[model samples]
Target: MDEMMPHSHLPAVGVADDEPSLAGVIAEDVAAWCRRLSSTLLEETGESLLGKLRAEADILRTLVDGEGSVVDGQPQAPPYRDRKGRLRNQTNPVTSARNPVAPPMALVGSDGESEFSVVLPIQYQGPPKTLHGGYVSVLLDETMWHAVRTALDGISFTRELTVTYERPVPLGVPLTVRGRVTSTDGRKTFAEGEVLAGGEVCARASGLWIAPRR
Candidate 1:
């Protein structure tokens, strides 16, 4: 958990005005910082960086609550003391996706819905630079249901999922997934997702999600 390793190489932050410009600079800095953070965590923990990250999220919570600084030019408020209080809570589903954790995919722009993209590396490969089918399903399911959760507020789980692959999802290439809820019936939610490469759809998915039973 050496914070220095990931962020040390990042460009020094300078004062900037407005959100857009500041976001661009902060994005670049965070990317570099994440790289260092991942490498350092791997070296020290002998576990996936995502695992270390989850373990340290509480500490990050404290820092974010105490400091309340601008991240990527967007001002963020303090962290919630409990899961119910956080703006976006990923702990439950993230824990469900255990065995091998999914990395924190970036939140791209949303056209009235939620969109995200994740870059798979050699380590994430399943078949000669192709992403594993299971991981693909996980990504699609998580993003699709998360879109619903983002728009509304509730705990949900995938009840059923159907994914169609038009082409093999290549590794090392950025895979973009976008999703939105089509409709909801009480505890059940229906959603759809599209996986894209170079702006072309490679795979599409539809899912039925249900609220987790208490």
Candidate 2:
């Protein structure tokens, strides 16, 4: 019961083409087919391999993409790295990699603080290899609303969060999430987070954000 759920900083930006485009290689090939169907939906046991993964998601949902195949102007902005922050969030599904139910995130420090890393495969398990206390409280309520929207870049909304599990988060390793902003009043804002691994600290969080009125 790794009392789960989970940033600070805003100075690690980078990404000016240099490479990867073609819609970032088709959104990392659909986030690597959603990390290989989230690790084969947690180690496929049977049912004819889960009916061939629902018949390959119904033949990849007919190769979606329409509306004149978008691309008429802007709205593609894809850049997300956290360790050496190079951020951007085209309709976040946690850094949407074509939103394959998102497990994507690579945000890193900047301004008020933020950081990321997650490895919750095994279908985001729970009680066994851990992680799944409401998905660690929505990963500490979306990293305390992206640490007050990347320190007042705008938008925020997690009016409360308070996780506190001190251990047991080990489903395939890597786990480090952080958030910041420990103050602010009018329109309320206050955040905190933690969920380390090898370096200890299992879980910790604190939040209450707002920021509506413009």
Candidate 3:
């Protein structure tokens, strides 16, 4: 068990909590507990405790306000919506507490390459102590397309996405995500991405992005 005692030396999730970013961070923290509750229920919760959790969840659901559309100028994209300064944006299901797939928190960072990192937690597990394949695919696809928004002009949509799992990505670890432009043919943009854990590649993806006529 100690071998999987978590990568104790990993850096903390790096995100600033400015006035604009506060809400997103709060949501991330809350989502984390949701993940914990889910996994715990699967492992050790009994019927009584499960009922209590359901009641609590229902209460929270009632409190939730409906989501509105993105503002006039903000980029409207799939997988997540772009917010001015929020890391855990309410508009983004990947980082939103209200969404089932969101991790507790993910830290976005760059290393002189066209890539970012989202710190994952145990809540996003599939195989024991490993990240789920579906989440991995989305992470690569969304991140790659998001990266494309910067590299190309006009709104781009994911025409195709291909993901290859290199290794088992550990839960509760920082994963480096990168998407880079390889070339372009007319309105088509070609990009490639990879996810790395502890400096080792875990997944790779190639995507085709297109600018559809309005």
Candidate 4:
């Protein structure tokens, strides 16, 4: 009978013993033990630990390439692709709009007190050539929220917002909205905002924001 050829690359599995070869059985047991241990660590430590492990695994990957050794785990990559269509390279979208007199006002300042401005075009008219009252209200709301954030500490959400239009905001000119926090009481904060054009206040607003309960 012909003798079995030894695998040069792979380590021998069987051990010389009177009983059945223990190398294969021991390796399988060790692998299962490692899997169970990793699962337990993940369950106890949560996702942060997993993220660190993934980063470390990536660093170790260079050592194993071209060695005919394949790690059983998948490569860690971001869920979304980048603009260039490469794996793991991605960017968050810009949150601010080009124009301020619109829904979903864009954030404009690094500090809590933020100022945003917009030029009223002829197309955004209420009557003949004046800006719409609704558009003015949107600016007031955004300004008030920014003010509230500036005055208070921690995160806050708007509770009640009220605006009073003083005069008609003219079109074909730039309108500036300034927001600042007036006062705060525990979780509740009070804020004031105003829309100005040509150094005159066209609209004014006051609002309350409540900090989320822990």
Candidate 5:
């Protein structure tokens, strides 16, 4: 609705091949198409296409069980080292390219303040054409965490978070996210974040974080 911020443009889904696994990007494309298919009317051709895709998925399921850990017979992702030899989480529900459910909110800037943006697709919808309230809170919490991480220069865990929903966030629109540190008290840090859509504040959140001792 309103003009997007400078440098806030998100890259096309599945185009993020810079991450460790090319398969992750490919999976993002597949997941996106699956979401599109969910919103489409199924005709004869569509049903036939689904059959083919199911067959291929069965093959993939067999091939992937070897990589990650198994718990209760389900494979779980494990942390892996990146090109720089830094260990990275296997998947992050908010920002990891490997997780299909992620709006994969992108961080654009963190110079004293943190800024992120995401375009929620059909899969993230709750009530007609609006994003799920839970996800709005997730974005706010994550943005606040980034604000604390950047400002405090260390890892911290959220102690408490409070969110207020001001308006319904629509699906398929770019939403601006912003967060900043409000103050610090010894090991405790405080921050707030807001999600804006169409130039209006759709939701706001404030959080307290506890930084681990160095």
Candidate 6:
């Protein structure tokens, strides 16, 4: 299904900060709360807590919404790049410390192949104790593109992604995701990736990435 999604022309670049910022820490905390809420069953109304959260959300929205940096006295718009000039959106969602929705994915290694360790929570459950197939596809696509940006030349976009589900991805268990370039032909680069649970392949994908013309 990832193949049918409209491709964005935005440049894919760079790794996130090696160290976590205060904001990143806060985001992760919020994400943790969200995960708890997802799994918890409430016998009574949560309106009081919901009200407090709504007020907090308003405060946060004011701070983050439409906020941009003043680079050299020039106000930049949304989607600002980091100090290292890497685009913010290109940060690894799987391993991002700042994104609340991002799973607790830790980077194991990335030389030519990008590898990550992750465990999907109940929020990502599609069926009884299994990871959603769509999320699996998205993760594979992201990892494969990360491999392309890490190992190939120039910026690339997803042209096609084919994901095969071998087994149900069980939630709340350790999983490994890995991607690497398999071959390159002219403007296109072919990459393959997989998600493994309990040392066995659960989901695997192959994708075509195309570098735009300069």
In order, candidate lDDTs are 0.58, 0.66, 0.60, 0.55, 0.68, 0.67
Pick by TM-score: 2 or 4, better one: 4
Kindly list the per-residue Cα lDDT of model 3 for residues 107-166, writing each as its tens digit: 343321255667766567799999889888877765666566666555676777888898
Give TM per candidate: 0.55, 0.39, 0.61, 0.49, 0.67, 0.67
What does the lDDT read for residue 8 in candidate 5? 9
Please list all clashing residue pairs in model 6, or write none if there are none: none
Lowest lDDT sum, 10 consecutive residues, model 4, at: 90-99
**Candidate no. 3 TM-score:** 0.61
**In lDDT terms, which candidate is top?**
5
The global Cα lDDT (0 to 1) of model 3 is 0.60
Residue 67 in model 1: lDDT: 38
Q: Write the per-residue lDDT of candidate 5 for residues 22-105, one digit (tens) a residue.
A: 344345445444544554422225777778667656645643543332322411233355556565544566775545556667
* Root-mean-square deviation (CA) per prediction: 12.6, 11.3, 11.8, 26.2, 10.6, 7.8
Error of 6 at 25 (Å): 3.7
What is candidate 4's CA lDDT for residue 167? 91
TM-score of 6: 0.67
Please write out the lDDT profile of model 4 over residues 99-143, one tens digit for every residue. Answer: 121222334653557677766555457877787897777677656
Candidate 6: C-alpha lDDT: 0.67
For candidate 1, the TM-score is 0.55
List runs of model 6 lying over 4 Å from the truth: 1-24, 41-93, 108-111
Greater lDDT among 3 and 6 belongs to 6
Please give the distance, in angstroms, between residue 2's alpha carbon in candidate 6 and its true position after superposition: 9.2
Could you give candidate 6's per-residue lDDT for residues 17-90 as a string of tens digits?
44234344444445555545544422124886676566656655643442332222321112336556765542
